[model samples]
Target: MDVSIILILLLAGTLVTLFSGKAAGKVALAFGLLALGASVALLTKFNAHQNIGCLGVWMENPQIYFALNGDGLSLAMVLLTTSLLPIIMYSTFGSEVKNPSSFYALILFMGFAMVGTFLAADGFLYYIFWELALIPIYFIALNWGNGDAKERQKAVVKFFIYTFAGSLFMLASFAYLYTKAGNFLIGNLSALSLSADEQFWIFLGFFAAYAIKIPLIPFHTWQAAVYQKAPTAGTMLLSGIMLKMGLYSVLRWQLPIAPYAAKTFMTIFIVFGIAGTIYGSIVALRQKDLKKLLAYSSLAHVGLIAAGAYTLTVDGLRGAVLQMISHGFVIVGLFFAAEVIFRRYQTREISEMGGIRVQAPKFTSMFMILVLASVALPSTFNFVGEFTVLYGLSSINIWFPILGGLTIILGAYYMLKMFQNVMLGEANPKPFADITFQEGLTMGVIIAVLFFFGLYPKPIVDMITPSIEQILSYTHKL
Candidate 1:
């Protein structure tokens, strides 16, 4: 089957589902499953060693190319995209969203753009999809948000402008590189020789874009508000999958292409990452809103991932990738749990919730497991990822890991405190309900994945190692 056909099928399905009305949920699910299967087939047929250019043309001076190419890295991201969509669609079934057709359409379209971002070999083409992915999400947040109209609009707009500003700098960086390389293909740009001065400026542009997206401290202001304001499904998608795009790009574009600059300025990057981790944890400890707290905690976790990635070791890269996957699952479960609590209490404030576990043992149990995972407790996926990252950081500097390790303490403090306030405190006078079948199933799947991969993470580590090797090889050549 043609890859283009797969893309078309997804695009067409989203369009068709927009007109499906109430049945849109079912239609979207069917299309998502089909897309997932087709993606798997495409993976099997993909030639990892060869470049698959789609179409190209000559510009005024430089040549322009539009293409889809897959190597280990792009394929891994594509797999992540396809694997998550069906689950997200399934999770949405439990949601009480209005205008289901438009909601599903936006989600499917977002999936299409995410896959395109991973597959596009040309820098300009990739940028187009990078920006395109944000559009559906903006609408998703605006249309489906839970907060008051003004607050939701403000959050969505803030997210949009912050990310867009960073993207523009990224575009400028790529244009500069294109002038020197005379080609827009990532491989060609990676091969081009660049001076340290040039690499420094280019790296800045790339870092600005990625930092805001992954949203390491300072730049993370937009996230908690947006997460709190957006609907549950939108929050899941944003935290669970969309944030990975930034981290993935850091690996795909920044490291390999500007190795010397990265190496020279490594300390600054590591410092920023560590600062974000500590700062995020400290702030999360104070948040009253459950979703906002989880959002800040996620910021802290991904900051550690970023620090590990910059360590430039095999273990560091592998751990970062694994953590990306693990965090995605853990955060989805966390946000889903938050949704359940909100449905019962009609509020996300922890102080307003209590005795929830009395009537909702199953819900409480699942929430506890997810919280443990988020806090990096032993025998969970978070533990495996966090341990590996620390080990990776240890090789760079004992102090780096030592300072970064503070997150574990802070993470536990806030997480357990939130749990104690919401679950262990005296029962509130208001009535509470037990967990629903759908909610239980969603959390069960996430918890099972957490433990399964935590106990045995070698498979994903091995799969990702080859791509890390390929990326690191470019750095060595530099």
Candidate 2:
């Protein structure tokens, strides 16, 4: 029941899929399900109060360990990562991917890295997994992406350089922390006593990485292009799961290690997040490209999620976690719908797509749920997350929720506008095919999860509350 088993399954899936030739996609899906199953089994045991973590020294001098733990917080993320990988893989079933082996391998390997990033309890080891997750995505986007080659290359390169560069700051921060704490374990680093100035620089160092990875406001320049360029799976991985790495790191590493600075700097970062929310929603309204619209939509969602986390309140942290899980599913479904439309029409342009509903009733049904969920309509999982987040913001100030709530209003306008343009009206007569069983299955799974969680969020809410409280304890020290 060790949490490392999830990483092992993903790595094995990668190796097996790499040699699987034409069957690589199927192999990836099978392995992905296994990892998902593993995470679920571990979850049951976890609630039963069993140890599902492992530790061993990986390096002597720097004192790093092959430490992996599944606190409820980490497991929540691991569940998100594991659950999405199969759907992401299966979403590509209808595409004619060149070099399926390498492509599927990269997908599995990226999952391996992300699972490791979530579970790694040692700081140095976590960085290793974090950076490793970047490599596969870079190649996935650069090689397998849509659009003009030169343009896609530029976007992917910018993403690579931006993320890798930001990570260096995190690495530097970790190095400094190691010097003071003498070990890179989470407990040790979070326990360090540092001067306010030390905490400030350290906080900024981590913030530099997280803000870019989260792509909050000014640092978000790289996201739209990359999302538009990447293949659907790559896009899903980026928006659904990878985006959470930075948000999770804020909870796991950044704040606890630099509590005083987190408290001191909270106001400014919260403003940054809320601004991104407003900016992204407005931009989404303007997007002509479906993927770009969804990209900006995701930017809006994560912006609010980031703002909630920075609030450092129980409501804030809880809402952020819930939103992260729901957003992971919703974004993947939105991108998959985009990819489905593109497969039929050979274009990402919203203007070029219409009347899909007249043709594909199943697709229209599922996609409509996704659209409403994105707008946080009641009884959708997203509604719960968004309401919780807004409640957190309102707890802080009438103004926080007032500004952040604009995401919902603006989000609904843009999302429904895009949906009406793309899915409604006259059937384009270009012969739109209904989604295949495989595609329908993926969308159905996502919609089901959203509805189920929307109705019953208590399980996850309970799971993460203890961990969130622990984090607040650290932040409250200021």
Candidate 3:
């Protein structure tokens, strides 16, 4: 099957999940597996030099196409999305969602939009997929979110407005690109020539959207709130896969399409990225809520990843991809850890958790491994990305790496402290039960991916290098 099959399967999943009655969760799970299976097959075909892609004209007047191609870079992201869907679904197996049909459908629909965002090769079509992704999550967080109904609505709306407004800038940017090139295909737009002023404004417009989406520092106001209120699955999708949409766009859309603008303002954006790293780490140290703390921690990591990307070196870009994939799993694992705790303790506040490690050795072990990975412990997959990114930054400026590297120390400080508080402090009066088998399995899959990739990053590194180099050739105007 072609890459379009992935989109088709997910879209089909959404519809089937919606009308499947009480078996929606199972239907969603089956479709998630089918999507995952489809992506794996594509990856196999991709490695064997088969063109696992589909292209068709969606509109003749505006020069748009329903294009989906699987280069190493795009395929890696597709794998991330497909791999996480089933995991996210499984992560919630122990909990009962009210209106399960709608809940599961929203998740599948969100997956559909996100996968499209990754696979879309046409600029306007990409923007459409990008915007389509926001709808399901808005409903997910608004309707199924925790906390007071009014408060959930408020947070979800804030998130939607901030993201929606940011996307307008992107839309405007694409409109300009269309005028210049008269086509929205990635190849045409990436090769389109424009004046410095034009590239600058276009770059800024894309940056506004990407920054808000990746949520680098000042643009990050909506993140923690929505994370805190959304259900765990929504949080997983947002942090794990949705945010990568921005980082991926940086290499795919921002850098290549406006090479001169990217080269000129690289430092400014790098500074923004590094600043977010430090700022997010600092803020995370103060969050009383577990999910909110993980949210900020995610901000810190993505900031570093973004900073690495703007370095514009092969190492920087490749490291960003590696980090993005690793971060996707690590962040999901961390948030799910929070979910596991919440399920057992009935509270997300750090103060309300303690001494669970004594009762739940299996869960504690997996959570601890995830914590270490977040801090970029040696030999973990995270270390590979973090070290590569820091190396890339160092090639530019010693202080760039120094500043960006702060996420490591700061992350360890806050994460370990949070872990200690949640799992290792004095025993609480309430009895704590160990994780169920399904929950253990969920965390186990995540931990296994982190370590396996950590030890053998060469496969991923080799796979994505050509695509990253092709992108850099554009940025370097070679």
Per lDDT, the best of the predicted structures is 2
Error of 1 at 459 (Å): 2.0
Q: Over the stretch 52-128, how does candidate 1's per-residue lDDT look in tens digits?
A: 33655535455777677666666666776776777788887876779999999999999888888877878888898
Pitting candidate 1 against candidate 3, the one with the higher TM-score is: 3
Inter-residue clash pairs, candidate 2: none
Q: Once superposed on the true structure, which residue ranges of model 3 sit more than 4 Å away at CA? A: 47-51
What is the descending TM-score order? 2, 3, 1
Write the residue-wise lDDT of candidate 2 on 299-338 in tens digits. 9999999999989899988999999999999999999998
What TM-score do all the candidates reach, one by one?
0.95, 0.98, 0.98
Ranking by lDDT: 2, 3, 1
Q: In model 2, what is the error at residue 79, expressed in angstroms?
A: 0.6
lDDT of each: 0.86, 0.92, 0.91
lDDT of candidate 3 over 1-478, digit per residue (tens): 7888888999999998999888999999999999999988877767623435788989999788988878899889999999999999988888988999999999999999998998888988899899999999999998888999998998899999999999999999999888888889898988888889999999999999999999887999999989999999999999999999999999988999888998898899899999999999999999999999999999999999999999999999989999999999999999998888888789988988888888888888888999999999988999999999999999889999999999999999999999899899777788878888898899899999999999999889978998898889986663
* TM-score of model 3 vs. true structure: 0.98
Clashes of 1: 0
TM-score quality measure for candidate 2 = 0.98
Model 2: lowest-lDDT 10 consecutive positions = 43-52
Query: Of the pair 2 and 3, which is ahead by lDDT?
Result: 2
